[model samples]
Target: MRVLSRVGCHLCEEALPVVDRVCAERGESYDVADIDADPVLVARYSDLVPVVFVDGVEFATWRVDPAALDAALRRPR
Candidate 1:
């Protein structure tokens, strides 16, 4: 999974704990890359931090509800 987040973004902060818990509980591996780290990503996701990509595909963005995230994760990868 790819999580596009900023260093101090509130949305990203909110999503982190949830994602961390899910990953730990499900034994899933995920990568959290900062949106501002890559120039291309900084441009693409400047206004949309906290974007989520699952299995190399975008699964969710902006607002991520835990329940929805859980459901998305539960689906066969």
Candidate 2:
């Protein structure tokens, strides 16, 4: 899983813990990318910080849904 975020973004801050907790519970690994750090990411998701991706596919946006994330993590790849 991955979270695309930006500095000073409250939504991103809020989503991180949910993602982290879900991933930890499932023993899944995740990465966080600051959209501002990558030009391409900024272009694709600047307006959608806090975006979550599982296996390189978008899973959630804006707010992180714990139940949904748990389901996604439990899904077979």
Candidate 3:
């Protein structure tokens, strides 16, 4: 999983712990990317800073549901 985020974004900061806790419980790993650090990301995710992706596919945005995230992690890839 990965989180597309930017500095000083409160929503992004809020989403991090949710993602981290869920991934940690599932023994999965995730990374965070600063959208403003890359031009393409900045353009694509300019208004969507707290985006979450699982297996390279978008999973959630703005807010993350821990139950739903756990369900996704339980699925067979």
Q: Which candidate gets the maximum lDDT versus the true structure?
A: 3
Q: What's the lDDT for all of these models?
A: 0.84, 0.91, 0.93
RMSD of each: 1.2, 0.7, 0.6
- Which pairs in model 3 have colliding backbones? none
lDDT of 1 by residue, 8-74 (tens): 8998988888888887877887899987879999988899879988888787777777777778888
Off by over 4 Å in 1: none
Q: 77, model 1: CA deviation in Å?
A: 2.3
lDDT of 3: 0.93
Question: In candidate 1, which residue pairs clash?
Answer: none
Cα displacement (angstroms), candidate 2, residue 9, comes to 0.4
Candidate closest to the true structure, highest TM-score: 3
* Model 3 regions lying over 4 Å from their true place: none
Least well predicted 10-residue stretch by lDDT in candidate 2: 41-50
Better of 1 and 2 by lDDT: 2
